[model samples]
Target: MVTKVVVVVVVVVVVVVVEVVVVVVVLVVVVVAVVVVTAAAAGELVKVEVVVVVVVVVVVVVVVVVVVVVVVVVVVVVVVEI
Candidate 1:
């Protein structure tokens, strides 16, 4: 019974992770397109700013995903022990 529950949790986590990754990838592509268009209309300064923002956003998203995964793992371990 416990094993089945753990397996379901693991499967759900995997699905969530995959969805997050897909969303991130799509967001990056869209952001890149917007940046390119804006830079072309604006200038080098704006391009640099946009690139910096994109980097920061990506980094933050990665950190959040890592933290969530860690928390889920800890919860799963606790549940299993119980």
Candidate 2:
């Protein structure tokens, strides 16, 4: 019974992570497309600014995702240990 519970938990975590990854990828693609279109019409300075902003946003998102995954792993480990 404990093994079954752990398997379910692991499966759920995997599904959630996959969904998050898909969403992030879609968001990044959309943002990049928008930035490209805007940059084409805007000046060089604006393009540089947009690029910087995109980089910062992506970095922040990656950090958040990493933290979430770490927390989830810790929780799972604790649960299994119990």
Candidate 3:
């Protein structure tokens, strides 16, 4: 009877240990995956922000050029009329 009890206890302990190891490994993998995915998302956001900034800058430059050209043309026309 004592031998049977000992065998049962050993089996229980072994099973518990295996379960703990499996849980730890799964947690570690989940944490790593989250970190990697977050980093990739952050990188993509930075790229998008950069593209937006470049586009805004280009638009502002074009607007300024158009305004300057209109003013110059008006002044030349007025001088020619005078």
Candidate 4:
């Protein structure tokens, strides 16, 4: 009876230890994956920011050119009337 009790205790301890180790390993893997995903997302955001900046700059330049042409045309009309 004592021998059987001892065997049962040993088995329970082994299962508990194995369960703890598996939980720890799973936690570590989840942390690593989260870090990788965050880094990748940050890299993609930087790429998007660069594209947005380029687009904004181009739009500003085009607007400036259009405004200047309009002003020149107005000035010509005013001068011709005078």
Candidate 5:
């Protein structure tokens, strides 16, 4: 019967729409997961860079202080000998 065919067609269309919606939802979830992971990795890299910079600065400061101390001691010794 024509009515039976129409009813079957409607059911098929409904199923297709439901399937499409589920696929879209899954895609969204995958995209969100990837973004979160990338952000976390980037944040960690920034933290490491900050730590390395701090260490370099501290080392330079310490070296400069040691050099200044050595120079002062040498100057004092020369002045005393004269």
Candidate 6:
């Protein structure tokens, strides 16, 4: 029973980590593409400011997501151990 539980938890954690990484990568790519396109279409100075703002927001969001994921993984591991 313990082995099974451990295996399941490991699998779940691996999947979650992979999913989070993929999501963050996709979001970054999309955000960069959008920023670049918008900057090209709009005024340079205005769009540069907007891009900077968006990049910062994205960074914050990614950090939050990573922290949340880490917390969840730790909780799961602790629960499984118990």
After TM-score superposition, the amount by which residue 33's alpha carbon in candidate 6 deviates from its true location, in angstroms, is 3.4
lDDT of 6 by residue, 27-78 (tens): 8796778767867867644456766787788778777876787787778777
* lDDT of the structure predicted as candidate 5: 0.59
Please say which candidate is ahead in lDDT: 2 or 5. 2
TM-score of each: 0.52, 0.50, 0.51, 0.51, 0.49, 0.58
Could you report the Cα RMSD, in angstroms, for every candidate shown? 3.8, 4.0, 35.4, 34.4, 36.0, 3.5
Worst 10 residues of 4 by lDDT: 43-52
Error of 3 at 53 (Å): 35
lDDT of each residue in 1-82, candidate 4, tens digit only:
5665566557556655665565566556655665676588875533545545655665566556556655665565557556
TM-score of 5: 0.49
- Top candidate (TM-score): 6
Q: How far is candidate 3 from the true structure (C-alpha RMSD, Å)?
A: 35.4
**For candidate 1, what is the TM-score?**
0.52
Q: Give the TM-score of candidate 4.
A: 0.51
lDDT of 4 at 6: 67
How much lDDT does each candidate structure score? 0.73, 0.73, 0.59, 0.59, 0.59, 0.75
lDDT (tens digit, per residue) of candidate 2 on 1-82: 7886777688778867886786678578857776787778766434567667876877777778767877776787679777
Candidate 3 has an lDDT of 0.59
lDDT of 3 by residue, 1-82 (tens): 5665566557556655665565566556655665676588875533545545655665566556556655665565557556
Ten contiguous residues minimizing lDDT sum, candidate 1 = 42-51
Backbone clashes in candidate 4 total 0
